[model samples]
Target: MSEKYLIGVDGSEQSRVALAWGLARATERGADVELLHVADDSFLSESVAFLSEAQKASEQMLNAEIEYARSLGFTGKITGNAVVGHPIAELEEASRSADLLVLGAHSGSRLAGSFFGTRAVKAAATAHCPVAVIPNNDANPNAAVVVGVDGSEASKKAIAFAAEEASFRGLALVAVYAWMPPLTPGLEYLWSEELVDSQRSAAEEAIAIGVAGLATRYPDLEIRREIVQAPPVAALVQAAEGAELVVVGSRGRGGLSRLLLGSVSHGVLQALPCPVIVTRA
Candidate 1:
């Protein structure tokens, strides 16, 4: 069977961007697209026919997107899925069997990210497969693909995904590793030069390891290595400036297994300027 990509569409403008992104990817990969719409009656009047009306409206919205996709020349099949439940819960359940879960992000202040309870963040945290969060605007195909790296299994997986995606897109791959300087109490003058050197050395080694073997796989692909002495989120987000897509690990080196998403991944998601794909093992 061919791969299937599931995308959430809520009739918002961001949803339109996500729909276009999903269809383009599906068309390129010759994979089918699943259009998911969750209708919550939270604010609707509690009438007898409200449930059916919600379901009908959701299906109609999905079909309209399908028609629009076809008009844009998408040849693959896009199945419509309508569900009545919490958006996050339904999307997470649907993403279990999907090859990828695609979502749209709202353009707003970063401070409102946590309180907004955006569906993209919550669903990406729980999805079994890789989750792609697309921005409100389209991407420039010529821009590079950026991947965050650390000496972790998740980072390794992200590296592989970023490499393959870069090769597929025929764009450069940028591997980024960040080191945070330690804060000491009033002993700044005593800080060792050797410690700084060692930290930079470790970051270099991590970049080399993360990008190992990609040169052979993609001979024509350009690879850029970046090592910055800053917080991981800051470094990765800065590297992702004007990038086509930013790929990151769901969890970092020291993240706990019980945590759905790592701190760095969440931070990058909040601050990144382009679309981000959060990969999991």
Candidate 2:
């Protein structure tokens, strides 16, 4: 079966941006695109007439988005659907069968919350497959694909995904491993150069292990390594300054069982440096 990308559409400008990005990617990979619009009927559940009108409006919006996709010259198989339900629940359900879930995030000052006002984050955290979050603004035109690696099972999956994307796009791949000295709040006096160097060496080794056999797998791909002595979020956000796409694991080594999204993934999602793909293990 052809690959399928599920994109959430809400008639917002951000959603339009996501539609374009998803369609372009689908066209590139010869994949199908499914645009979904969920009309929240929570408030209007008691009013049958209002619910019906809202559903009609949602369908209209979907039709318009489909036309917009065609206008962008997307010739692949495209379908749109409108349903009455909670957006997050509907999207989560649909994403289970999709190869990818793509959403749009508002950029600049309008980012009051994470992409899609926390909905994107929730979807990404709970998605059964990979989730791609595209920002409203374009990424650096000449940058390579970037992936965060922490030698965890989840990050290993991210590395594979990033390598495949870079290979297919004919772009370089940057594997980043960020590490910081282990220090407690009141233990600044114990800080030493040796500790820093030890951490750096460990980071290098971790990254080396994380990217092992990648060259063998993607023989033609160019892979670059970056080891930064900073917080994972800061390091990744900086590395993504001009990145085409940033791929990260949904959970990291320090991830708690209660948290669906790791600190790194959640932080990176909030940063919105570029188009980010959060992959699951």
Candidate 3:
């Protein structure tokens, strides 16, 4: 297989951190790293004179990022490019041949991000390959790889991908299954111990089944499984606290009926503390 390609966007401080992380990861993987900065024409239409100046500044920023990557001991060849177009469309086009796309989350801007979602989310949903969203916070120390598995064919593919990543990075693979009580009419205020136990037991059994095949496929990799009783997105964010990377299926079996990506995967991508990888079926 060819060396993985790590692509990072340069826009904000969060993007800078993402570039640093991507550089570190690429160094470890012996992969090529590309730093891209998209100069949207719409962003510069207000001032015709400022447009040229802004483009020059953007080129400088890209050059600085490449120098920073080189300073970090990344001996592999690094390429820096600046393009003019819609940010999301440019990124999606650039990601066509990339092995992985890495992005950073805007810090303390939920409402703005929600009203006008970031380019990262759009690229992740539409990209042909996997996308990794890294948060702009303190770096995670542990090298654990957390993968969300729901027993769907797509999720099984995600599990296989996660296991391969864990093996390659020499990290522990954590397979997580989030389960909740089924909703029934007129049972809103009722608490049933039997129901809780049954759900927990079923979750454990399902996790066992999912991890068994991965364990056999990657015998040398260390694996751990967790059965959490909560929403998949919440459980995944909590599990991502100490994890280096989080993996999830692009869509689930239930969402297939409606031809939509699962809300869980979408939510996790927004709030996850570490990088997230979405695998296709």
Candidate 4:
């Protein structure tokens, strides 16, 4: 596992919100925060050919973000650095060494507004450590912490991490499991209430098995389980309402099926009201 740290200030307003959240988390953990602004030379290669100028501006922004963090009573040390490369690649490389990578998701881009923005999607897909994608609207303090479990190794790791977070913050952990009836042509229309209930029960049982060990480890942590009959992505996004943090496994039993079925983690990270942590197995 990488060292515990939070990151912020990636040159977007959404990132500023993410920075604030990361700063608060770092303060709580008594850990350091690295304010990084990667200058993607490829993006501005033609517009701003001067690498030094871009680096200098990035450094200045990093310093300002660090100062803001300090003003917010984050006495923990803050380090600022600027690197020139592809934003996604550099961030992924940095995440290999950091405990957590926090990123801000912009709400204005229509492309991103509908799904995980390009940068956030790339980082989440490639990052080695947990990546927290923070939305701009999450400012509440009493929101619950939500996680999605599908009885996979990655989901199990996500549950363990989320349970620890909920225990540490004294917040409720809401575990969600999404189930759907088989899509066979005639079988699809044949769906019945009994089948739905049975599927939901099985999902709940799987969630219980996935969380049993963590619940034992954190006996005092408050947890709630939900089995929803919806697409995994939609179910997780809905559960993220009023949540301070959301956790999801990078890969699940669905496996390479993710390419065709889509990823619940990607969906939640794109639309969630709060930050999302994606854990790898």
Which candidate tops TM-score? 2
**Can you rank all candidates by TM-score, best first?**
2, 1, 4, 3
Could you tell which candidate, 1 or 4, scores higher by TM-score? 1
lDDT at position 63, candidate 2: 92
Lowest lDDT 10-residue stretch of candidate 4: 107-116
TM-score of every candidate relative to the true structure: 0.90, 0.93, 0.83, 0.87
lDDT of 2 by residue, 42-137 (tens): 667558888889989889989988888899999999988898887777887898889999998887523446337577888887777899988888
Cα error, residue 196 of model 1, in Å, equals: 0.3
Model 2 TM-score is 0.93
Give me the overall lDDT of model 1.
Answer: 0.81
lDDT ranking of the models = 2, 1, 4, 3
Error of 2 at 130 (Å): 0.8
Compute the lDDT of residue 11 as modeled in candidate 2: 72
**Residue pair clashes in candidate 4:** none
Tens-digit lDDT track of model 4 for 9-44: 755667777777888888788777787777668756
> Candidate 4, 212: how far from true, in Å?
0.9
Task: Give the distance in Å from residue 153's predicted Cα in candidate 2 to where it truly belongs.
Answer: 1.0
Q: Which candidate is the best by lDDT?
A: 2
Count residue pairs with overlapping backbones in model 1. 0
Candidate with the larger TM-score of 3 and 4: 4
